[model samples]
Target chain A: MRFIFKTAYEQDIRLFKHGGQQFWYGLLGVALLAAPWVLDDYFLGQLTFILIYGIVGLGLMLLSGYTGLISLGHAAFLAVGAYTQAILAAKGWPFPFSLTAAALLAAATGIVVGLPALRVKGIYLAIATMAFGFIVEEVLARWEHVTGGNTGIIVGQLQMFGWTADSEESFYYVALVVAALVTLGVLNLLRSPTGRAFVAIRDSEISARSMGIHLARYKTTSFALSAAITGIAGALYAHKLRIITPEQFTILQSIEYLMMIVVGGIGSVHGAFFGAAFLIVLPQIVAMVKDYLPPAIGQATGLQPTIFGLVLVAVILFEPYGIYGRWLKIRTFFQLFPLYRRGLFRRQKAFMKSERLR
Target chain B: MQVLQVVISGISQGLIYGLIALGFVLIYKATETVNFAQGELMMLGAFLGLTAVTFGMPFWAALPLAFAGMWVIGILLERVVLRPILGQPAFTVVMVTIGVGFVARGVVTMIPGWGTDTHALAAPFKGELVRAGGLVVGMEHIVVIAATIALSTALYLFFRFTRVGVAMQAASQNQLAAYYMGIPVRRLNSLIWGISAGVAALAGVLLAPITFVHVNMGFIGLKAFPAAVIGGFGSLPGALVGGVIIGVVESLSGVYLPEGFKDIAAYILVLVVLVVKPTGIFGETASKKV
Candidate 1:
């Protein structure tokens, strides 16, 4: 194991802890920048989706994973973003302005939802968010003049100033830039006092309050920020799909977002990207493996969900830390080699913690 | 008369929601884990009843059989899937249940005869109607309301008088203390799951008459969340009351309000209730000591 002696306080909050991390991240960044040329258009499209989902995953990770607040209605924010972008685009607004408006609108809605969230915690908060999701869906469906109701509105191509991103490769670059900025922003935020407050609140709300952290302000800020990030992803998603519909943002879609963050690893920024890739790739993998299995199992309409459900269950049961956690374990096993212990990462035995009292 | 008719129908519909919510409360009370798959279990129960009926069994016999079968499945689910994950965060448990729901729905759809098609369960009182004082009521609705009343009464008595039921209450109140008192908390948890499943099965059998059985029927479980919340998370009778309130509001809105209000009336009501009274009507307040 390589250990770095930290002689300065600046080293504690450094974006890159060691030379190895900086080099690997730089290499990874280069690979992403070159991906459009190296990979086929089909793969590039999938990568773009991973970028979009990664953005949303980061948003959710900040809220649920770091802040200890769970939302089952993130898709509603995505809808807000998509619909706003679509509407503004139809009105011939600039791409940057539309995207900003989408984020702001979603943030506003998030605040509305977060207000009620202040009164509840845990499962109650989950249900309230879910109800909010259902209500938003209903509104989107009923507001025919603006949203086009069930028929859905067509989204225009990405237009920036005078130039238009008509090609898939150009769109990919746009998404890459936004994703990088967001990732860097999140990294910086985490090392700051605000992010520390979020982590503290997540670990123990009472203790966080006792330490003078403003609970209501931080919670609402987290919700607004999370929603804004997700909204940006929604704008990209709308352009990619070439259509915006109310049906696209449902409870199931929200669940899928939750699944991405959970499967990726909840607390880590890298986990969001890992989860986005996993979510995109899992379906493709299932489609490929379908023909190899027997007709009864393979051709069944329910096969995809069955596989997805089973995988989710298995992941929760075996590796609660998710794909990122598994990667960490593997890396540790190889690093420690002969001295690796089985109980190195064992979870502490937890008794049933009652929510009733809280 | 029309108002009464709507209210009556709403009560019956709400009763089904209550029945499902009852299952949620029972499981929540015992294990403190919310079962998101409660609706899927109800769907399975309906399918089981349908299968039994197709095989020439009477509806009466099929009902009990499905309940019993679901009871066993519930126990197995608790023992095999949930028991291993004991003491994990509530979020993990909730997600597991959601996964279980997906698997249940997927497996049901993959079944040879079930597939994606909707199937009507053959109730003995399929199309019969009763007219009283210039008001007409479907026999199916009456049967649902009657069955719910009977079940709720039996449950109330069970929790009140029976030793096992009292033991369950004690376990739910304090798991460690109950275990220390030799109440077999773990086993009781399994049985609570079984009872919850059985209750859900009964709800399914009753509900199948109003809405046909289908793979997607489990989606109705989402609506039950509002019901459970309105009644307070831990209160049994609160669930029933909440369900009825949601039902009446939905039914009334379908007729009185403009186009989409009916679809979201329950949610709106729940949101209002959450804003007004977060713990629900019967919810008890407690402070945690750190």
Candidate 2:
């Protein structure tokens, strides 16, 4: 298998040329599409949330992985969308139209936030976005007329031409389809000229600027684009929960979205889904073990938060690219079996050597 | 007279923020990474102090003990969570800290007795009003303001005069050179983190009286970030100046601005500060490396 895959020719870089990659991706896709049919209500609900986060993660992949601008404020965009859709839906607007408006609202806000990126880079940009998130939450809480003030406004069922999307099953399918479509859109985006420019900025902003790429324009556009996707997810979430409180849009949620990006693999398009799934599954598993704990322990201790912290710490300490990146490598290792390990190590060493040269 | 009182009140509260900013500066000085969880650590400190006080510990004893507890927590946090991710891109480390912050808040809220309920940390000084020639003030407020100033002065003196201080400064200025100079740079880094945590606890313990001690108190850290920016990210004194500026603006806004705007007063102040002087009042512009 290794012999057949290895090539001396530069043109032989076949990602899916081997049957294994195709088979694996195909099987994975099938499983995802089939998930709603087999899963119970609770699991379906959680899966829908994961898909929402995965959609947000796709945006982060573009901004952080592609454009190299770290956004701590993506969740703020999510909040903007969630709040916007809730308000619109409460006013008798169609669900589809509200969701679209949610994306547009987020994109508009994203442009405003992205303008700051023209001046600030990296951590500075992160802080600006962080501030933006805080400001958004404050607005949501205070704007009583539109946002139900501090109490927050609840959203009605997602109505698509008289069909209700209130059940976990319907939401599951909706989430799956939306996630797939958004993922496709994002992957395609990465293949475009703007995507390459984002990659160039990520590698070296000065070189990118030198290459005549409008750094500010692309950098900020990444924020707008990422925010729009996150907003769409937020809109879906608001509809799913039937509640859109300012509390739901805390800065903490922003951190969770970031965790998705990091845990799934910072730059990979698929990393978001992988990261969101891990987070969602871990908590569910934790909850499932709840009954087994001693009453005293269960009553007193916050095992859930403690577990989250430990998982985050563990992930950062070892697999920085997250489980997804590691899984990719592990799959390749198995595909090549014993013979492939040598090739992997060789590639890694060369990669490391080149980094040192840089 | 009322306006003066408000300004004084703002300055005093600002002192506490400045102190928090001091911790931020101290950590940033040693390690370039920002400690997003410092607020949570501070909240933990006040809670610990509350526990200490309720356990019949004397104020002095409880304060110092709580400070020590915070220092240990800080060190443990760095050793367990942060140390491993030292060389990862700044974004990864920041996100880790942010996660750590959430975990801290969640854990604090989860404590059986705490239950997200707000409680007062019984202060030694009764918040009795003192009429200083028609200018009313709380005695406790005076104490907090004084203590922050005194702490800031001590830090300034220590940094200027002491051997360890100078070495730490050297580390902050250039890590490679400090390492080459036989300084235990990594140990120094841990110590800085520890010290920063202690300072944050002190700020929290002091601030807990005015704002009730609860799980959400950790969020005051968000407000403190604006203080850091206002003072200039790298400047210690600027933190003091920035905090006071934000405090006064917040107080005045709450009094005079339309209801909703006061909630965003600190952020607006930060924006103004950033616009006026991006590096902050006392910050020097940094040159990009070639």
Candidate 3:
């Protein structure tokens, strides 16, 4: 194993821990930037979607993974962001301003949801967010005057300062830049004292309270930030899909977001991106494998959900740390070689911790 | 008379919600984990009942078969899938249940006869109506209410008087202590899951008459969240009462309020309840020791 001796405090919070990380990340960045040229338009479009979902995964990871707040209604925030972007775009607003407004409105709604977070917790919190999601979906459907109801509102192309991003490659670049910035922003935030507070709260709220961390403020802040990030992704989603519908943002969509973060690895930034890529690639794999299976099973409408569900169960049972966690294990095993023990990653069994009491 | 009619209908619909919520509370009370798949279990139960009926079984015979089948599936689910991950975080367990739900729904759809189509449960009570005191009530509604009452009474007695039920309660209260006391906690948990699943199946069969059996019918289980919350999460009677309240409010809203309010009435009520009394009507309040 490669070990680096940290001589300075600055080294502790460095974004790239060592030269190896920096070099690998740089290589990855170059590959992503050059992907549009090497890959066809269809693959580029898929990459753009992965980037967008990665942004959402980042937001969800911040709230659920780092902060320990579960939200089953994040798709509502996405809907808010998408609807705002579409409405503003229709009004001939500039892209930057409209995007900012979308984020702000989503953040505002997050605060509203967060108000209840202060009172409830665990499953209750999850249910509350779910309820909020359902209500938002209903509102979107009923408010046809603005949202166009079930017919869906058409979203225009990305128009930034009179430069319309009509081509797939241009849109891909836009998504790439935004995703990089958001990822960087998240990385920096996590290393900060604010991020530490979030981790603290997640680890133990009572302990965090005793340590002088303001619980209400940080919780709301996490919700707002998470919502804002998801909102941005939603804006990009609207532009990509070219149509905004109420059905697009439902409890199913929220669960899919949860699935993305969980399958990626719950507590790691790398996991978020990995999970997004997995989600995007899984459908393609399914489609490819469909013809190989029996026609009855292959042609069934429920095939996708069944596969997705089974995958989720298998992942949780065998590898709770997700794909990123599995990657870490494989890397560690290879690095340690003969020295690696069998029980290196075994989870300690404990009795169920009751969430009934505050 | 019209108000009474609405109220009566509301009670019947609410009973279904209560029944599903009861499943939620039972599993929750025992394992301290919410089964996101409870609704899907209900859906599966309905499908099983429909299958039994199609196979030349009587409606009464079909109901018990579905209940028994779900009970076995629930026990297997607990022992095979859930038991291994017992000590993990609640969120992880919840995700697993969600995965189970997806598999259940998907598998149901893949079944040749049950493929993404709405089905009617062909109950003997299907189109009959009873008019009493200037108010007309569907025979189906009466059957739902009667069946719910009978089930609730049976459950109440089971918990109150049975040895196994008492042991299950002890286990739920404190697993370690119950183990020390020589109670079979793990086995009890599996049994509790079976019982919960059986209850959900009963709800599904009863509900099939009113809504018809469809894959999406499980979505009504979402409304049961509000019911569970209103009645408090831990209390059995609370779940039914909460469901009734939600159902009545929804029924009233559908007629009195604008078109959309009915869809969200339960959720809005849940938010209000969370704000006003987070513990719910009969919810016990406790604080963790340092």
Candidate 4:
């Protein structure tokens, strides 16, 4: 498994632990930059949407995947950001200021939602977040002045310091840059003490508290930070579509965000991006394959969700570590071909039944 | 008189909610896992009943058939998807249920002609009304209340007296201990799930006359959940009381308060209950093992 030798202490903690990882990431960056030129307009739009989803997934991964908190209300935060940005942008607030306001407002709401975490965890916290999401959705739908009621509000074009990202290619580049910055920010945070503290909390609250980590502060901080990033994604999402609606941020959207992390591999930055791409692209894949299926199943718009739900169940049952974990397993098997034991990948019964370490 | 009318209607509405909340309590008590699919199960039951009626079956016969079908679905789900992942993390089990719900809704929505359109479930009562104290009460509401009482009493009797019910109680209290004592813990779990699903089906059948059979009706599970939370998640009787409280508040607020309060009344009640007593009105205090 150890491809590159690391002699210095810093080498072990570096962003890319090996030369191979750096090379792959460098190649990925180039591919992303050249994607607009290579792909058609339709695919470029999909990529932009995937990048935004990736940003939201990263935020959720921090709260749910790394911190062991379950929230069915992330979409509420997205709505807050979208509405905030839309309202501010319509009022002629500067682009950066409106975006900042969106993040701040979302973070404020996140903290309010996180307050329940002080008293509850697990299923109860999930319910609280769901309630929050519903409340936010209702408020958005009813508050006509801000959200334009059921009709929804139109978001203006993205303009920053005399630069307009009116074209699809330009907007795609904007999304890509924001996504890259957010990803790097998350990577940096994960290496910091706060991220480790989050992991510790996820593993065991009792042990984490014993280590003098303040539960209330850190949990809310994770919520705030996660919401802040999601808010940024929401702002970009609004600009990308140039229109926003409360209906767009439903519980289903929130579930999709959770699915991204779960399918990609929870508790990893790579998982967030991988899950985002997989989910965003899944509909296209299904559409392509639909023609080959029986006519009875082919025309159902609902089949995609059914397949999505089944995939979630299958991943949870068969490969709890998700797509990234499966990738690791395959790579390890190839790396140690002909020498690997069958039991090497067999799940321990104790781990299955015992308390989860997230 | 108006207040009394509101309370009566609220009680009937709450009873329907209670029936669904009862399913939540039964499953939670038996398995210690929240069944997010309960509402969808209710929707499936209603649709099944509608299908049976559409096929020329009498309303009375269709209702029982729907209940039985839902019971089978519940048992199958527990035996197949749930049993395989038994003893997994609570979060994983919860997510699986959520997935189950998503699949259930999707499958129902894909049922070709019947799936997309809303239809009326033609019950025997239909739109018969009774006059009482200058208020007209629908007979359907009375039937819902009556059925809820009958089912609750039957459930109470079963748990208190029947051998299987006693065994189930023992298993719920401590599965390992019950197993050691020669009880069929796993079988009891399936039985519990079946009963829960049956109850949900009954709720669906009872509610169909009032709301009409629609795919989106399962969203009522959203309201029912708050009822469960308000009553204390694990308490069966508490769930009923919680439902009543939520229903009465919503009914009154819809008339008295400003617009939109009715929709959020239950959720607000849940939030308040959680803040004041996180364990809920009837839930036992759970202590962590440090």
List TM-score per model, in order: 0.98, 0.90, 0.98, 0.94
Q: Write down the DockQ of candidate 1.
A: 0.60
**Higher-scoring candidate on DockQ, 1 or 4:** 1
Which one wins by TM-score: 1 or 2?
1
Worst 10 residues of 2 chain A by lDDT: A349-358
Determine which window of 10 residues in candidate 4 chain B has minimal summed lDDT. B168-177
What TM-score quantifies how close candidate 2 is to the native fold?
Answer: 0.90
Compared to the true structure, candidate 1 yields what TM-score?
0.98
| Model 3 lDDT per residue over A192-308, tens place | 999999999999999999999998999999999999999999999999999989999999999999999999999999989999998999999999999998877888888899999
Error of 4 at B78 (Å): 1.0
Alpha-carbon error at A78 in model 3, in Å?
0.5
**DockQ scores of all models, one per candidate:** 0.60, 0.32, 0.65, 0.41
Better of 3 and 4 by lDDT: 3
Q: TM for chain B in all models?
A: 0.96, 0.94, 0.96, 0.95
TM-score of chain B of 2: 0.94
Candidates 3 and 4 compared: the better one by DockQ is: 3
Best by the lDDT measure: 3
- Model 3: fraction of the reference interface contacts it also forms: 0.62
What's the candidate order when arranged by decreasing lDDT?
A: 3, 1, 4, 2
Which 10 successive residues of model 4 chain A have the least lDDT summed?
Answer: A349-358
Report how far residue A292 has shifted in candidate 1, in Å: 2.0
> Model 3 misses residue A309 by how many Å?
0.4
